[model samples]
Target: MSVLELVEADFRAPTLIASVENTKPPATVVDSAEQLVDQVIKAVGKNIVLGAPLAIGKPISFVNAMYQRAKADPTINLRIETGITLEKPVGKSKIERNFLEPFVAREFDGVPDIDYILDLRAGKVPSNITISEFFFKAGSFMNSPQQQNYTSTNYTHAVRDLLDKGVNVIAQLVAKRTVNDVTTYSLCSNSDLALDLIPEMDKLKAQGMPLAVVGEVNTNMPFMRNHAEVANTEFDFILDGNSKPDHKDYSLFAAPHGSISAEDHLIGLYACSLLKDGGTLQVGIGSLSSALTYSTLVRHQNNRMYNSMLSDLNIYNKFPVCKSVGDSGKFDEGLYGCSELMVDGFMHLYKAGILKREVFEDLTIQTLINKKAISTDVSLATIRALLEHGAINETLTTDDVTYLKRFGIFKPYIKLVDGNIIAQQETASANLSATDTLEWLEKHALGEKLIGGVVIHGAFFIGPKDFYDDLNNLTDDDHRKFCMTSVNYVNDLYDHMLGNQQIKQAQRKHARFVNSGMMVTLDGSVISDALENGQVVSGVGGQYNFVAQSHQMRDSRSIIKIRATTFRNGKLKSNILFNYGHNTIPRQLRDIVITEYGIADLRGKPDHVVYTELIKIADSRFQQQLLADAKAAGKVAKDYQIPKEYANNTPEAIQQFYKKYTDQGLFGPFPFGCSFTDQELKLGKALKTLKAKTATTSGKIKAIANALQGPKLDHNTEILLKRIGLNKPASFEEKITQKLLIAELTK
Candidate 1:
């Protein structure tokens, strides 16, 4: 049960080695790609010890490849360690013209080890030969008992069963981030084995088991720097590849649109009111997280102004803002980040001169990272520049300075000249005292800082490049200090140093942490099950962990912000329908529900009030329909109408507000960095639409032509036309006509 015991349990096993004669990636990986099919068939025929994690974009490719291999080698047993099976819709929504027929049903109908097929219609896993997992989202997550015990129990049994049956190698395609920590997993750098838990690796290694761990490298994924990393040498064979998954695009999914909602604003507003100028902050990703961060930034920038005027002025009652709060408007101590999703917002906070706040670690060395001693090659320079530019204060104490130096943070009094460290003369120990350290740090702190408490550690696509870069660059001692799971699991060990004032404040500073997006409602119960008609818009991720954690933490609230409506058939409809065929967070657990219209404080509200708020945010066009349904169900009165005040503040009105501001050049699209050309914008929209459309060959080709020959008739247009399935016309007139069509489209 203890991590130490787990490590000791499986420390040794026989090493399974497979030398790949060909290391090059297949040039043309298709459903009928012969080379890959041949390789897989050969492995199956030989009854390879394990089946590697298979990632393929085209569902048919996976089905065909697996089907062929299984047919050729009946005796060869197959096991799938990772990845998910794509499920088509059973019933049609307005979005789908017809009920989508199952595509891979034929391949899986009688396969012995096909495991389980996740039926999207039913939230629960159906009884099947293989395990059926309805939701399989990839991310850097925290490991709770559910993950460490329940999830691991199934896996351990499966692996043990295989081993007993004489299967030697268990090839699994785990998220690259889940392996041993680069910060912690570095000690075994020279060892040719990859492991999930230390005890397993140690046990198998000790038994002289021929264990071969494959490092499934997804190079295109966003790499993050954390107290975890896996050395390249640990994996016997590194299978480098990429996958085209239907992941949440941050640009389209940012605050107020995707995950962020109005309820987040309410909670964030409450949290900001509680936070003192120097307090720390931690938030998960999504609309609510974004709302909290964005609201905090606005407060700091606008000189302690309130964004929305709610009834409670609990601001003063919560935190004691200093007399000179405005001058030190920024979250001076910089809020530390503590949430599972270390998203773009966290990075933005740091870049905005707020992330330089103190990090509190249980370990002394990690205190250095808290003090920013172990500097990021990119963040270090950026933080230093901000300090010099008056964006942040440069008043770190000698203890802070010393720890930073010990941890390799080059700031304040030190400068790294051509890779050599140098101490600044003005910041020498001879000139400082302990009192000055506290005063200086507090006085010179930024507006906000975010320190996160992540549950799941690694996955494809969510980490930063700098995080991986730093882990790879760390020295052995540094790596040992940084990578230890004990150090990284700060939340787990928060109780160890409860008396510490900083840690206590850090715990309290948290406002809210959310579960992942989209909850289905079934018989008035809310659940997060894509299998139950809820398309897994985003994975469960670290939602349950942080939400539960926030509930336990003092002065903190657990908030769930959901769109009042979901986008279906090119229209937004009430997400809270008569029957939420899918439920994520049930009504009992639902504390807060937000829509663009307003917040539904449903925590203890009666069924009547809950109905009121839910319907308030529903689009006016659909509000009457929802009301009729609710009334028919006896949840509300037949005469119940959404208060006119609520109706007055609809999304149409919200859009109007933006349009007015846009006319005055106040807001429209990218208010910050991005520059969009008309052609580019149109192309982007076309691509987005195409992605949402039901995939058909004719539809796909038409989309391609519209994107290429229908954007602009410039030189680039000519190139695009040739690149797509379009053939060149013989006459100049035909070309001119095609170009005219493109010109019209662009206009």
Candidate 2:
């Protein structure tokens, strides 16, 4: 069956088909990790081609077992392909090592051994073993030689590339459940890559090639009831045992709360305001997402406060686009979220009632829905549009009735009888007067059918423990609202299949993809995944796809959020560089860029306009240098001057302005929610300050001097030190380090 057919089929009733050979090989049920290893060893030749899903979808027991087997047997050559390997970094320097080793040990105690990552970092990776991932978590492998040599690929093409490179063994974590005396395994978190892989693997197997598709069932894995959930028959091996320990819960990577600056909130306020009601939204995972979510909540729940915040920021006067695109009130129609990672922030939005809009499959119905001409209640105009678009015939047939009911055009009870529409006690002829037909449709609760449209569509999800809990706790109906589909569909605007292209694009309207960039050039070139020096920070995942798609759609926009400046070693540096060595999204694809300073609309703008607009949103301290560089390069007029209002875009100015509102309980760091304790939060901030201080020579000297002075500690300081396990130092070196930490904290 085709992929489209597979998608349309219900998960509860999977169609079993005979193979090309008229017989199918049954999946083996392994009782333990040892048995799984033995099977892998027996199935493998000299070389092992392994593929797994990113992050949480990874089969921990199986992979660790494979790693151990590979280690003991030198003849077993292993090639692993995956993405976003979640491993804690081994600190490179003394200070970094001192802080991170203890911190991680304390923070992630009892976490399962991610042996692969550990081996890779320790240079213990067998000479024959190769690890390749298309996208790495940002800054995870900054100094690793092996990772440095690994070339990056886009998210959409990762599976194809892996397969081409001879990935024959695929293993992923699955959720096992027993129903009707049958045990089934659900892909759970990541069916994004698996959906494409399974079909290809089946084709290859039919051609008589050797392939091992393994599903390691973990009882702890939440059985996500969406496109991701699948039957056990899909795999070649189902590894499960009641006696086996439950899969160790890998705590979801929690983004530090309130990491968002006041400036971030300013940018978020502008971006959130631009989002139209009933439009599609795509957001990434980070502090900026939290900021945007918080701002969106404020806009919907407290319009007066939202407006006041915008007014204080002078958003209307600064960006003319804000006056036109910004919505001042709550979302009656709500928004449809389409994102790569269904981060915890979406849960907050869903709970706030902001992520409530639902879009249908047909273009005609979608158009009417977008224009507010049609909803659950069938209107005369809706009927006319449906007829004009050939969605429904003048004389409603049984086929037409089924189609209408399917797309939410007709109420569930509204049936066609003798060429007439009947809803409970009301009946109207198909050829009746428009007014009478409208009255009949409106009298019944026909709109209820479309009320619970998909709130969010994600490819895969990985967030805080609370995020998983939220998903698990949702009612079946609410859970169904969070659809997990393939990255191919989520990342791209059009599908390769001709039939689904138009349908996919129409579903995603008013597309606002909010992504973050480390640095953006004056001419609108975005550098996100890597630095100018060719050091990889994060791999370019789906930013390019979203940006390109934004330009393709008429009303769509890709808003790139960036901080105006970053503090490095206690010195402020501009993120708006004149030029960068690498570009993820080129100047041609640039749509909208936002910084804490302001918003810059660069879409369809000329070189000079782009340069000026970008500079307008840059830190005031760096604007002159950028302007000078642009002028020297003949990109900007020599007479161009920095605007008077934008001159106040200094860090000090932003901090002061942000403090006023923050004091008033707005624009907080952890505005949505934070996982950290109050004490941990305070200590984290202090430790971060100390780390930054240690990076500079003068700061180090100051720290040493403070250590020599040995300042007396108060009750709060002593308690804080004990909380971080530094109150009573065991060694002289530790005692000195403790004194330095105390000095830094007190300072």
Candidate 3:
């Protein structure tokens, strides 16, 4: 099918069943890896087109088994299409190979390994097997052969392109559990492509095309219901080896909450201030998202604290935009969430009742909604406004009457006939002049029932174990509130074929697509997915699509949050570059560039204005260099100067400001929620400090010398050292390093 047709096709919820009835069941349960390889060899034949979901949904056992089969048989021509294959890159340099490698291994102990990624990086990928991906997890494939030959495509189009290439085999990790004495399966982590692919595969099978759908059942995969849950009948085969004691837990990619630097909170605070009460929001992963969620909570639950923070930061005075755009009060109207990945932050917002805003399908109705002229509780005044705005005709037709009734504008018992309104044993003029008709409509309208709109719409989700647990524990009704659809629908501004009148933009109003970037240039161009040196950091995921959509909406914005600076090899570096060779969201598409220092409103701004605003938000240490470059390029006047108010935009100032808040119990690293304990948090910080010290030769020597000096250790310090496996070392070098680490932690 064409991309448009595929998108326009109505999606039907898969039937939830206890067991497979009509379809053939699995012929055999493969208990061993060798057996899995043999099964794949038989099922795949000589040439095969294999498709798998991205990230956590990838069936590692199946993929590795296929890899083994491909290695043994060069005649097996296999094409694999997937995205976001997570792999840890073995470092190349001394610092990376020595310090960083061991640090990561110690930090992330249980994370699974994707053999294909390692093979691709080592340039040992079999010539017979081809690996293709649409979007990658940030920096997962940078400077590797896989990235050099990466297939660049939008998230929405990726599925279409893969299917067009004749993807006849589908494999995904699934959650299996017994329901009413029957084993049922759920697509737990990812339903992004599976929702579309499953239905399409059914059609292909009916057309007599060779096809195979395999579900690798892992009990560790949280069994979630919602729209993702489906019966085993959906798949032709089920790999149920997870019940074995030896089966390992699918490596949960835990993005441990990063420390929320003062700058991060400031950027988050500004972003939160721009959000409207009843608007639509789109936020991605990371500490910045967590900060924004926390700020939003403060705005809703603790107005006094929120307002005080804003005042302490001099937000309204420092940035005039906050005066008009910032909202210090609570969100009575709440918000709607539409994001590519529904991160844990949204859950916090939802729990706080800040994500309860509902939107309807009709554009005319949505416009009325924006103006606050209409609501679920329809009244005479609302009907009059609709008529006045030309949304409805004076002489209402049957279709108009139906539309009005559907949206609660007209009461269910009321009827329109020949320019007249008819009620129970009463009649009035259809011009809305009759008081009785108005009162009847208001009294009988379906008030909040009509407010059944989706709270959060996401393409896919993956987070801490608690996030999965929360999803699994949601009530059936509450679960439906978090809809899982394809990226094509969630990321785009308008799905022309969504409903009637395909011409108009079809999206919730006041959309704020908040994304993260590595660096932003003086001209407001964003560098997110790659480096200026032509190395891919992350693939261009859904950032561009959302940014484009933000411009298309009337009261929408594309908010790109970037740290003002970053530490590289023990040295601080500015993230606001004078110029960059590559661009993710170009200068033309730039909207609101937010840094810890301030917000740079670039949407439709002149080049000079853009430069000035960007410079104001840049790290104070690099502000002069950036200004000089802008001046040389003739984008800023030679005599122009940055305001003195922004001169305190230094790391020291940020640290001091953050310390004040920390005393008041604000700006915690994991603001919204955390899975770590207090001790772990402390230990993590100490480890980070030690890692930094080990980055340089002189620092390492100093650290070793300090260890030799023999600082006394407390019981708690010894316990902490044991927790990180540093209490006793096996080798002489390890013993020295352990002492150094113990000293660092104790200090």
Candidate 4:
């Protein structure tokens, strides 16, 4: 059958299919295993696709299954795909963690499933997983087939490419969905915008055709505010299956203590700088993203430090970003969110007193829009208002506006003016209530009109009860925001939102970045992929979108940060490796690459100059080697200078800094928020002490002494430690410290 027909069948299926239930493993395995196998599928070939619901460590079992299957059936091909990847926690037990078990197991298990597993850490490759691939999950590997690094940043180019490719079937995992008048699903790219596209199956469908859904199954799906859903029938086929397997208790990693990587921090700082005081910001979770947001928060909270930093950078002349969103971005007016990964970052923004809501109206309701309140079936006026306010400054021209008004925003009635509608009689029925109000606002209130309900429909799985509760109890206004149907329709709406002018601008920027990718170099020689040794650690996520969008935004810029070298197996190497077989962000599109050493100003610069700047940011340990390599390759001139000032910011310094704070007991693992019991905290501290003792060069005794005498270590604790390790005679002070430690552990 054709892809279109298959999609139709899936969307239109009348009966619910049998739901897959997880089988319990042997009791012995269950008791010993912190990580359990959710589903076991048999794949005969090396090339096998293990499909299941969203869960942690699905990758591990999938990999194992593929390897075993491939081993038994040697002729079968092997491939791996997962909805998400997890980070391994430090000093965590296998039984207590999910990622570490998979990782360490994978290492010991070896590459039995050859070919490739789509390394997310490094970005795009065939096989051979690298150590760098464990950073964090970005996007889904299931849709990697549809991911194309397009040259044009324009949404249309993306649309045109997909359309030309004749792709139609768009699969998404959503808690709930709706069928809009349009033929596509309205998937929220962020709070302010959505994408309507079909990537997998699109063939022989007449233009302006009414889309049909197939089979759909509904369960206890979490309903989230600030996001919307789609109808089950919106899909050509919906699988009416019960809930999939559960993968709860997924352990998360603790942030590394003491040594903060400067390169990551620099990138975050630069990105934060790009966000106008009130401009909407979309940041995922990671050291880099966290660093940027934290830096911004710290700057706003600490005026002295903020002033000093700005003065040192001589940015006093630049537009000072109002650390306050209301004062700066006018977020109180409303801000949009566009991101693939919806980390708690948005929550952070909301907690920080940003995240505003705004309502839109049609020209018919233009006057109401002026009043900052519009009750309409359409939202063009609101979008236009946002554009005027510089919230949507993506360069959509008049012609683009015309196109959107005609077909993009999808309003059935263009004749009805918003003002003429009687207060009691409205086109869209709003099932609003005080409960919904309280849930959405959650103490966050804006104007009478809560206009900031965001719609996001993608592969979703609600982990806990409380999380689900928060998502379900949204107001009527919040419900209208969701239009989950097909990925194609969602992407289409996104393009329409972009309109023509933005599309044109995106195209120009796209060509530039793509061409630059082609011209990317190794030793300064052009190479297609910049990834070292052609290894793909991670796939290209929405990097193209953000980069292209930044280029299209006249007032914004894209910044990429990579540490000069990563510490692995105890040694650090140049992050800007001499040659990479794989590349995520190429030099041509390399806008601002920041490292702890310094920033590499690559944009609009020649190869020679760019090479020198990049080398300057190379860590001191590897600067000489990198420059020598570049010079040998004739990428840099013989007299090319590597700034000396950039050197010597060693891990040792970071260690000292952390040690100073930790000795004082100020370098806490939970600096922001933590819910660990006091006993747990004491246990953790005791463990740290034990680890510190073992890590010291003089062995356990010396390390114990150093730790006990550290600034934060109690005065009594020093005597106790001396007694415990037999370094000094036991005394009253020692007795008191011992009692304290014991009490902490018991309590």
Span of 10 residues, lowest total lDDT, candidate 3: 1-10
How high is each candidate's TM-score?
Answer: 0.52, 0.88, 0.80, 0.52
lDDT of 3 by residue, 1-747 (tens): 111111222322122222233364533556665676566557646688889888788888888888778778898888888888866545563323543455456545777777777787778888999898877777677656776557777777777777898998888888776644555567767766776677777788888887788788776676655445665667876777766888776556655446676778888888998888877899978788878888898889988988887888788777777666556789999989988898888888888899887656566666666677776565566777777888777766666666666555665566777877666676666555566656655655423344224677687777766776677677755764676556666777554233332322434667788999999998889998877777777678888999998887777889999999987777778999889899998889988988898888888989999999999988889999999999999999999999998877888888887788789887767664655556566666776787788787888888888888967767887776666565666778767766776687676
RMSD of each: 14.1, 4.3, 6.4, 13.6
* Top-TM-score candidate index: 2
Q: Which stretches of candidate 2 lie over 4 Å from their true place?
A: 1-26, 41-46, 88-110, 178-184, 243-258, 378-388, 394-398, 405-448, 496-499, 703-710, 728-736
1-747 per-residue lDDT for model 1 (tens digits): 112112233221111111112232322222222344454444334344443221221123233344345445565444333333333223333112111222113222322222123322232322121221212433211231112111221221333434444543333222244333321122111111123332354366568755443333333222222332333334443333344354221110011123333344444444444344434344554455556566566555654344323222222322222111212245655555444334445555655666543433323322333445432332334344434444334544434334343333333345334422334333222222345433333333211222222222212212223433343454533322221222113232133211243443343353444433453231234544343532343344335444445555554445554555555654445665656555545566555444445444555567876776667655577777777778888988877777766666455665654454346443234322232334444443443454444255565456546545555456665543333212365676445434433443345
Q: Stretches of candidate 1 above 4 Å error?
A: 1-76, 83-196, 204-210, 216-226, 230-299, 302-330, 363-511, 519-528, 531-539, 570-572, 628-641, 660-667, 671-678, 686-747
lDDT of 4 at 447: 23
Assess each prediction's global lDDT (C-alpha) against the native: 0.39, 0.76, 0.73, 0.36
Quote the RMSD, in angstroms, for model 4.
Answer: 13.6
| Residue pairs in clash, model 3 | 139-537
Best by the lDDT measure: 2
| Comparison by TM-score, 2 against 4, better one | 2
Tens-place lDDT digits, model 2, residues 1-747? 212223342211122221221245557898777788788667655588899898788887789988888888888898888888887545564545644566567555655757888887778888777888777787787867856546578888877887898888999988776555554556667867887788788899888878889988766666765466555567888777755576444443433344776777777887887888777889987778878988999999988988888888888888888766556778887889989878888889899899988755456776677776677555556667788778777777777766665545666566778988888887887653466666766666244455324677788877766677787787877865777767887888765421156766777877788899988999899999987777788888888888887878887889999988887657779999999788888988887899988899999899999999999989888889999999999999999998898888887878887888888888777765665677766777877877777777887888789667867787888887876567888888778777877876676
Whole-model lDDT for model 2 versus the true structure?
0.76
